[model samples]
Each structure stands twice: as C-alpha cells, then as structure tokens.
Target: MAKIDKSKELDITIPEEFALRDEVRFLKSEDIKLFRLLRESMNKIEPAYVATYPPSECGIATFTKDVVTSVAKYTPFSKPIVVAVRREHEIEPYERIVRFQIYKEQRESYLEAARFLNNSHADIVSVQHEYGIYGGPDGEYILDFLEALEKPAVATLHTVLQNPSPNQKRIVQEIIRLCDVSIVMVRVGRQILLDVYGADPQKVTVIPHGVPNVHRVPAARVKRALGMADNAIISTFGLINRGKGIEYVIQAMPKIVERHPTAIYLVLGETHPGVRKYEGETYRNMLIELVAQLGMEKHVRFNNRFLSLDELVRYLCATDVYVTPYLNKDQITSGTLAYALGCGKAIVSTPYLYAEEVLADGRGLLVDFASPDSIADAIIRILDDPELKESLEAAAYRYGRRAAWFNVAVDYLGLFHRVLNRRRLAKELAESAQSTGKSASK
Candidate 1:
C-alpha cells in the first residue's frame, strides 16, 4: 500500500564533501558546570508529579509537551506524565519527536491515568482543558476523574468559548470548581471565561504562554537552501483547519500580490488531529484548490508536515510578515501567535481574543475576522509602509523580550509555589480543626 511517488518525493540532497564548520563557541568546564548548576537550581523544588491531560494530536499536545520540557529544564524536580488518546497513525508523531511514552485508548484510560497520578506523590495534577480532549457525547468522564482525584489540581483552559454547548459550559464550570487553580493565556480570554462561562476571576490566572528563545537565521540563506527564490515570503504556521480561516488568507493573497508582486504565502504546519471536521488532505486540497482558483500557484507555498523547532524558527524568521486569519473565537492561547511575535515578524492577525488583547499594545496589526479585504488591507499596510512595519517589528521584539521563556518559567514557578503554599495552609487548617474537635471530645 506504500506507493512511492517520484513527483511527491522531496529532493533533499546534501553535499558529501562539505566539511561542517563550528564558530568556536565552546564553553569552558567551569562555565559548563555553572550552566548545569543554574539549570538544576531552577528545577530543584520537589514538584508534585504532574500528569498533563491533553488531546492526542494538535497544538495543545505540543504546548503541553513544551511545558513539560520547560519544567524539566528549569523545574527538573517535577515528574511529568503526559497522558494522550492517540490513534495508531498518530503514534509515530509523538514517538519520533516528543520521545515520551503516551497512553493510548478511550476516555476510561485517560481517567485511569489521572487517577494513577492522583494516587501518586504528585503534589498537583494539571489538566490542559479543552472540550475536545474530554469524552465524546456526554463528556461525563472529565468530571468523574476530577471527583476521583484527592490531590490538589489545576486546569489550564486552552480554549475560551464565546458560545459553548450547555454541556461544554457545565463541564468547564465543574472543572473550575474542582481544580485548585485555573490559568489562562490572555486578558480577553480571562474576560470571556468570566463573562460568558461565569468562571470566577479569583480562580483564573492570566499568564501568557512563553516562546523559547530561538535563533533567527537569515531568510536569504534558508530560502536558497530550500530551493526557493530570493523573494519576500509571508507565512502562517499552525495546523490547517476551517476555523483557522486559511481559505480567507488564500483569498487575500491575490490582492497582496497586486500590491507586493513578489510576495509568497507559505503556510507551514499540518492538519491537527482535533480538526476531525476537516481531516487530512480534505482541508489541504481545498486550500490548494483556492490557490489554483486564485491563480496563485507560483506565489503560494504549502508545507504540510511536522517542523523541527529549528526549522520553525528558520521559517518564521524567513517570513517578511506573518498572517493568522483565524475565525475561531475559542482560540485563547495561540502558540502560533506567540511564535510569530517572538520571531519579530510584522504580523497581521484577526481580532481574536488574544490578538485583540495582545496586539492592542501595538505588537502587531489586526483586522476583522472573515474579511479577506481587511486581511489584504492590513498586509498591504505593512508592505507599503516601512515606518509602520519597522514600528510593529520593534514593538513585537520588545513584547517578545517580556514574554520570553525564562520569564514565563519564573511566573509558572511563582504560581506553583502559591499553589503549594495554599495546600500547606489548608492542611494546617484541617489539622487545627481536628485537634480542636479532639480537645472538645476529651
């Protein structure tokens, strides 16, 4: 069944005789030891082993993995168990890249993993809250797991819905009630949770997702290496889904080309597994069809595959401007949005919850969602006005400095410490109450 297509096969040939060169950035033994010491110091606290409940495949899983990795590097004392419900085909993606063992099967297995974490010495368990990650139909299992768990827990809400199903609303409310803490990524997301879902603000903490400090290589070299022309490239990276508004971006492309003639739209990343509504090549081919229909065959490019962190950094830096025309109101924490900002690419995004809030600080340009003309106009504004472009780029980099991984790591640690302190106080209170009752009995 594995038919090899010569046309589709990538021609990625490296020269054999070329010697690899190093720029002599070697660290001294003392320096190495200091680095290790620093890394370990950050991770020294005995964190209650965390079991992150995330979807099988998609950005949520990727973000969860990144959080685990960041915690391991900086907060190494925290043992993390990543529980996933994966299909046979999706298994390799996790195995090849994440290198962590994941549990596969139904919602019961997910609950079992949560229960196991609860029974363990884990101080706290963190669930990456998204409706799709929980059980289908009734969504009864998430509540069941929470009720079963005796240990303190936190639920990081990945999506903040504008109009949620009654069941979705109920489950989310129950989650908020069950968990010790609820963390969100943006201000608007927090607002939506409170206003729409009636979540208590006291319970929710707004900590933006941090972007790792990735090296930005020159676009010219990367483009040449990738066999692409030395031209201005615009990129939109993330799994392709209908709610992502990729089709609208493609529609905006013709107009963008009319202004910046040589501009190419490079859509990086693949279809997310959570996007069951538009699975596999269905969404991809539809975008391709739109590209062809718009006569943007030469100008538009697609990379429907998993990209290494280095590759992602390279492509993001290579982009002249990044576009995220998402129509989803629920996308609260956008790693794509963060990645674009971190790279300091002059961005044009729809006024989604995060974009509307974060970009208000003038980090990036914003347009109305679903309006191809609005997207096109924003793209043209950046392309035409160098002053504006530079302003946005500088602002983005400034914002990135604050939103860096190290800073975010510190914030998460603070939250962890607070959660631990709260737990300690609760224990003391319970002991006091019990001791008083014993004295009364005596």
Candidate 2:
C-alpha cells in the first residue's frame, strides 16, 4: 500500500494512488473494523446521501435494497434515498425512502426524477442499471437521468453482454462516460466495457456481487426444519422465464431420480414480471406438463411465489445442490448463483460467462449448455462422490465468506471516499489558481 504525502501541493494535481476508486483491496489489506475506525478518526467520511431504486419483486430492485441496507450499517445518520422506477402498468407500494418515482415509458419522468434528486441533499447517486428495467430503446432514458444528475454518481451494471447491439453499445458507453465510477461484479464485465464499449479502465471498479453476510449453517438442520430430512434438495431460484432453461433441468431429473431416489428438484420463484405481462404463465405451464409426461411429478416441486429474503434464505440453507440452467451464454452476473455460492452449496451450472469465472478452480461443476444429459451427469457425479461434493462445498463457502455484503460495502465506501476527496482537492486547486492570478494583476 502506497501512503499519501500530506506535504504535496494541495492546489495542484492530486498524487497518484496505488489503490483508488475501490475498497475491496482495503478490506483485504487490513482488519476491516479497525481500519474503518482509523480512517474515520483521521478524516471522517461522512454519510453520503445516495439516491437509488427502491425494493420491488425484480432482481435489480432487490439488489438495490440489499445495498442500501449494507451502506446504512456504516452511515447510520442519513440513510440512502430512493428514486424508484415504476413500470407503465404497475403501481406497487414502496417504502418511505422512495423520495421520487420514474414511470418507465414516460420520457419526461426521467428528467423529473433527476431534478428531484438534484434539489435534494443527495451527495451522490447510486444506479442499479439493467436494460429491461429502464425505458426507451436499449434503455437510453437512463442517459437522460444520469445527464441531468448534478451530484457525483456510481452505477452498478447488472448485465454486460459480450456482443451487444449498436444501440446497447451506445447506451452503456454513455453511462460509463457520465458516471464518476462504474462497478462490475466480474473482471469479465470490466474487460467488455473497455474492449467492446471503449470505457475508461481507471473509472471501472470490480466489486464482486454482494451476498448476505451470513455464515454457512448445517444443511441437515435446515432440511430437518423444512421437513425434508430424508431428501437431497436440488434447487434453482430467480425470476423464472424461458431464458432460465428450467425445462432442461427438469428433463434431467428422471435420470437423477433413477440413480438417487431421494433427490428432488425444486424450481423456486414466480414468473418474471416482464415475461408474465406478455406471455402469461405459458412457459411455466409447459415445464409442469413436461414433469407430468415424464411421470416425475413427485420428483419435482414448484414454489410459484415471489419469495421474501427470509424464505429464500431458508430454502437455500437446506439446498444440497444449487443449479443455474440459464441459456444465455453472455450473462455476466447471476444473483441466484451468488447466493447459492454464498450458502456453500455444490453448484451445477451451464457454462455462462459468470459461472465460468466464479465456478473456476474446482469451486463448482459446469456442464454443456442446454444439455440435459450433461446436467444429469454432473449432478450425479456430485451425488455419487462424497469427496468431490465436499471439496466443492468447502471452496464455495470460502469464496462466499470473502464476497459477503459487508466486505463489498467496504469497497463501495472506499470508492465513495476517493470521489469526495478528489472533488475537494479540485475545488481547492481552482480557488488557489484564481487567488494567484489576482495577485499577479496587482
């Protein structure tokens, strides 16, 4: 770690830093609690006013809520504010933290929301970016919001496509340019932003997806509580849709059930709102019918409800094997996968970009995409070999402990502190330069 020189010119360019715009490194370097206290005593990083999306049923909404909670743990004085986005036809109740709302299809709504934040005491803006959640072509309306924002901002991009369309390329590039700092869950996302979107590397920070800061519990204990002590729970969770490739997992269940009679597959989650609005429950019905046709109705279960954090965590704790059969090969992040890993389950996933990187080094098993046989074989391998399963569980648990939300918050606040410091230094430099010019004239 490079130390800052206090004697350096305060009115000129700030000194270069070995670790800037990130706190993950800081947490890893020293004791998190002690270092945070030390920094607070030396120079208190005040509680920043952050405006972001409020909690909802969607992935991005839930993500924003969790982040706000973790950030609040450090900044107890002023909790982050919310600028929740509402779908055109949806009218869900929100918490009081939601100071403003942006209607998805209304162009002017974005401008108004931005202005609302600008007028508030918000020191910074936090964006939970996703193409589907925002309005306009390729979610270009977010550009308007970011453009109108007057405060320092950081955006956490949920999706990073390797081969994005021209419109998507434009929107993401603009987002990177507008924000003070950009965060990605994986290094793969950072590379795509640089090589594909031509973003500034220095502005991009890799903060692994934040998981609940909970320790691994005994699987048997949770299974017994759920009244499935005799069964091996194979679970997949998230907003279910065609993109989830759940049918393939169900198709693989017959083979798995034949080999291990106690193995039961659990598809946990309600249909995605976007999918439900247009297609209804057509896709979910298809999977249910397939289960019947295979005569494996008893072997599979569907919890057709949007689970709360507590319910979701309870099931996750009981899970023996977690699977993500998503078809999209380009997906850069999966909250479901992160939670599964955090719970220390033996994960069996398709070789999606996020899975490939995180599940590397023998942490989890990966099979061919959309291949039921491959999926079955991998699940069986884990079930059949106790040592392999234990190793994967151990590795996943270790990584989960490191990537927990509290540690991730350390990185977030670290980056926030850096931005604030830079702004202060720049203001001083400008004032000093103006004073020198006046003296010369006299």
Candidate 3:
C-alpha cells in the first residue's frame, strides 16, 4: 500500500503542471501547525458582508449558506452577513444574514445595493462568482459592485466553463483581474482560467470546497434508509443534465450487469431547473427505455428526486462504486465527487480536469471521455480487483478526513488573513508614498 499523506485536499500541493495565480500555497508542514496555533490563539474575526447570488434553489446557494454558518461559528470576531439578491432558501434565518434584492430589470438597483454594502462596515467582501448568475457575459454587475465598494474583496469562482464564449471568457478574466484574491475549488479550475482563458495567474487561489460535519451520518444508517441491501450499487448523484453524460453510465450498465448480475445503477438527483424546459424528462425517459431495451430493468434504479443532504449522504455511503460520466472537461468542483470522497466510496469518472487532479492521489478511477467501453472497463476492474478497491477506499478515506469541513474552514481563515494583510500593506505603502511626496514638494 502506498503511504497516504493524511493532509486534507486543500492542504495538498498544487500540481506543478498549472501556473499558480496567487503566491498562496496550501499549508506547508510548518504552516499547518502554525494555523493550529492561530486557531487557538487568535481572537474571533467578524466578516461584515458576504456577496453571493440570491439564496436560490441551487447548489451554490446551499454551499454559500453552509460557508456563512461555518464562518460565524469558527471565527469568534467576525459575524458575517450574507448580501443576497433574494432570500430563496431560508431554512433558518440568522440575524447576521442580510438581503439585497436585485431584479433583472433594475440595473440601477444593483448599483445601489453594491453602494449600500460598500458603505457599510464590512471588513472584507467575499463574492461568489458564476457568470451565469450575474449580468452580461463578463459579469458587469461584478465590476459595478467592486467599483461601488472600493473595499478589499475576495472572489470564489464556482463554475469554470470548459468551452467559454468570447464574452464569457472576457468576463471571467476581468473578474479574476479585478479581484484582490481569487479562490477556486481545485487546481484544475485555476488552470482553466489562466491557461485556457488567459486570466492573470497571480490573483488566483485554490481552496477546495469543504465537507460539513452535518452530513456525516454513519454509512450503515444512511444505506439502510435508501433501502440499498447487500447488492453492489453504482450510483451517479447530482442534478441530471446533458453535461453529466448519465446516458453513458446507463450504456455502460448493460455490460456491467453481464458480469455482475446483482449490480444496480442508481441515478440520483433531479434534472436541473434550467434544462428541464428544453429536455422535459426526456433523458430520464430515454434511460428507462434503454434499460428495458438492454433487458436489465431490475438491475437499474432511477431515484429521480431532489434528495436532501441526509438522503444524499445515505445514497453516497450506500453506493459501492460512484460513477461520474460528465462530458465537461473543465468541471472543477463537483459536489458529487466531494460527497463520494466524504463517504470514502471508490469512484470511476471520465477524464475531466478535476478528476485527474483528484484521482492523482489514487482515490478513484478515471476513464476516457465519452467512451462507454472505457467506463464499463473501469467499473468492472474495480469490482473484480479487491486489492484495487481496498487501495482506492483507503486512499479516499485518508483524503476525506483532511478535506472535511473544519479543515477547509481553517484554510479559508488563512486566505481571509492573507487578503486582510495585503490590503493593510497596500494602504501603508500608499500612505508612505504620499508622505514622501509631500516632503519632496516642500
């Protein structure tokens, strides 16, 4: 067995292949220990405002909520407030959370909201960047917001497009250029912006998304709830969309069943709301028909409902082999991959950019893109090779423990501290320069 470095994913070294944007390195051996000391010694820091899209019915919204809660609980000094377009999913509204509504028709309203947040006592403004959510191709609203609030801001890039349009590329680049510090969930994400989109490499930071302790129910308990018995289940979780390439997984299923008759393919999560209008259950219906055509109706299960966090964790734990057949190569942060890693489940995914970076730790299997045969081969290889499965499980378990939410929170704190320090330094330099100029004039 290979020696697994138990440091969390966020702490993992960026592969030398990518051009690093920010000078920020994942915690060094000494730095990790230092952060531990700071964690104990430092006073609580309050974040005045966090700017993300409205708390809508989406993963980004859910992640934003979790991050805010974590920041508040972990940082004693900072009680950060959420600046949102709309309060979409408020399971429990906290007093620290504030809302800023921006309708599509009102461009001036967006500026006003930005001004309000800027004028407030917010120390650092953290913006979650996804071009689709903001206005125009290059996130013009982001520019407006940043301009309005000359205060220091950090951006967490959520979606890095694999094939970006000219305008989309420009917007992402502009956002990266303007941000004081840019965060990405994975190194692969940073590379896309720098290498592919030609964005400034010096401003980007890698802060892999963290797993919350809230969803860490016992594996057996979770599996039992899903009614998954002793059968080996290979499941694909998350919103169903064209990019997910779920049909490829379904295609690979027939071949998998030929070898392991008891193998079941569980297609979890709902189709994305954005794509439902054009595709209206067409993909799900097609997969069902394919299962019937392939004569493996019993071997496939379609749990096509929007699963709560608890249920999703149960499904992840219950799954023997998790398959991500996404066609998109630029997908950086996959919630499915994180949950699967959290459960320490063996993964078999297509060769997406993040998959290569993640699987490099020997945590999972990666197959060629858009190839059903390759996908089937990877799945079968895992099932047949006990040693391989054990190795993957062990590696994944080691990785998951470090990538846990608390560890991620610690890394984020480091980033916050860095940005704050940089801002202070810049201010000091300006003041010094001003003083020197006045003396020269006299």
Per lDDT, the best of the predicted structures is 2
lDDT of candidate model 1 versus the reference:
0.71
Off by more than 4 A, model 1: 1-56, 87-107, 215-229, 274-279
> Per-residue lDDT tens digits of candidate 1, residues 312-371?
776777677888899875667788889777777799998877887778777888888799
Count the clashes in each prediction. Answer: 4, 1, 10
lDDT of each: 0.71, 0.83, 0.72
Where is model 2 poorest over a 10-residue stretch in terms of lDDT?
Answer: 8-17
| TM-score, structure 3 vs. true | 0.83
lDDT of 2: 0.83
- RMSD per model, one decimal: 6.9, 11.8, 9.3
lDDT for each residue of candidate 2 in 235-336, tens digit (9 for 90 to 100): 999999999999999999989999999999999999987799899999999999999999998889999999876678778888889999999999999999
Residue 46 in candidate 1, Cα distance off native in Å: 4.6
Residue pairs in steric clash, candidate 1? 43-75, 43-76, 48-123, 49-122
TM match of model 1 to true structure = 0.82
Clashing pairs in 3: 21-201, 21-202, 44-76, 44-77, 45-77, 45-78, 46-77, 46-78, 46-79, 138-171
TM-score of each: 0.82, 0.88, 0.83
